[model samples]
Target: MTDRIATFPDWQTKPTVSPVQGDLVYPGWLAGSWSMSSTLVEMVAPLAPEVTTPGFEGNRQFLNQPVVCQVRFLPANVVERNKAILPLLSLPTQSLVNAQIVSDRAFNGLNLAKAYLGDRVFRVWIDPRDSNRLITKFRDNRKLFSTATGRTVEQPDVDHFITTELFQQFFQSPEKPYKNQVETTTAYTHQPDNTVTADQFTAVYLQPPHPKAFLAGDRPVALYHYQLKFVQQGVR
Candidate 1:
């Protein structure tokens, strides 16, 4: 997993990750609310001429702009104790006993999607029994169903956590249903100043139903990188 983040935009094939089962655990430090700013710094189309991605050119408008949103990770009693990690002691007001730190996916995902997709986003929900499945619904009656097929996690230190999840996505569209693979890798650092910073990389791969799927194969056709800064609420 370290090798994947070290390589950056040199990505070609998908990272080899284990099958996703339970919610991804976050470090104890990340167990709180945060105001996040995500800025798109770079984007690339590896096979532009032959297989340009759908949103390659349209995304250029957001190149240097930061999308601000609210997100939170919390401690929850995950279903499987085998996947549990020792979370820090809970706050006086918050009881996190026998809980594993996990992202509030529905709350965080909804707010984040609205930050980019605006009010057009109707809802974002995850399967109650399955942490790997997610759905984002739009007001236009379109929905994006995503399932985390594989993932990998690493923690070099208590202050640093890295995770990469590979998702199989199906989009309900007016013309046709679109299927693709999306990979997101984020390296988060907890700073001494009580803030958090991260480097996030995303890749989009064409899948079977796509006409040029054969040409793209397992390689990603579109790549994007974002710089993320998070500040806890009420903190300077």
Candidate 2:
């Protein structure tokens, strides 16, 4: 009989840290209302060359026109936990939460919609240990399960940041417009003139056999590039 041996993975020996203990800070410059415009610059369908993927038609429609949006950030109570205080440890220890609201445009810019595609409120948490790093949590009504991580760079005349997010859609059936994963990278610069500009790139990967000859892992399905401009209106 052959001798059998068992081996454990290296990750099993590493320690895990809790996410709740991390501190979150809000940037003062981003706390205000603004008018934002997003334009689709380029798009490519790598996997679905024969058929049109979902959302491609809409992107083409907005390729020549810009989509307008109203964005606002409101102050909210931030709470931190104190382990020293046993009975009231869960009480308010910090106040750094902000409520973000984004309104969508409709009717060919003739009218604004009462409802928004991003109607749900979003929250951003800055890392206490590192001011440049932050995390964003999406609302309940959002279409995908997403985790966003960002880093900021401070300059003399401009503050620049890059955010990368991983998204997984909530589709019931596997055949329902199969999308395995989507990654979005956005680079924003806060200019000296109090305006912000962003260049965004989004890539969608799909399960294989949609393009059978591709590699074993997920294949690239679509690529989208967008340009965004935000003009400060006033404080909310």
Candidate 3:
């Protein structure tokens, strides 16, 4: 898991460490009430077709704004014998999952552990420079139960963004059978209710140059594109 305190070296203020922080990220360029509709294009790995529901398709559906990007609520190794880890001690073993929203363009994120899993928790950090960027990091220390004797492997960076005007992706394998690309652009408009509809969000995906039996002749896969929308409610 990524350390929340270390992630924001330039934060305007110290975050009040808690189970949730959705309200803090709203009303800014990064915050808003958002939703999307995704459509699948190709099937490379032969996985089951994602079930489409109302207003969206695929498991890569909507990205509700201000969702928790990361969390840690329980100790995976230590038993809550006598409730040593807080309120959880009164009941059973305490384990927590921290979920947070790393970006509004896509479902980019990072998760950390406080007292569970291995001695080191896992984390996914997005590169701030690229809209479709991500980085994998790990945390090992006395908190998670690591005695400094083990080395945790870093996670591989991934781009969940798919080429579509709606800024969504296909629920495909993480090890993309073929390299994929994506880009996103954003804008905003004022609604009559005083809330601003932050629209003009667009994304595009193209298969990176690669040798494939399917592309034998002069045929090529077309690039994919999508557009997304969100509403930013002004703080009263």
Worst 10 residues of 3 by lDDT: 143-152
**What does the lDDT come to for candidate 2?**
0.44
Q: Write the per-residue lDDT of candidate 1 for residues 152-222, one digit (tens) a residue.
A: 99999989999999999999999788889999999999999979999999999998878999998888899
Best by TM-score: 1
Q: What TM-score, over all chains together, does every model reach?
A: 0.89, 0.53, 0.28
lDDT of each: 0.82, 0.44, 0.25
Name the TM-score of candidate 2.
0.53
| Predicted structure 1: lDDT | 0.82
Clashing pairs in 2: 78-94
Q: Please say which candidate is ahead in TM-score: 1 or 3.
A: 1
Q: Candidate order by TM-score, highest to lowest? A: 1, 2, 3
- Cα lDDT tens digits for candidate 2, 1-236: 00000111111111111232222233445545567787878777654555445677565766747778665332332122221112222322232123421111111121212112343435434345543233333465223323222222223233865544444433333335343556555666778887888877676655443454244244345677788888876433
Q: Whose TM-score is higher: candidate 2's or candidate 3's?
A: 2
Off by over 4 Å in 3: 1-123, 127-132, 136-177, 200-204, 207-209, 212-236
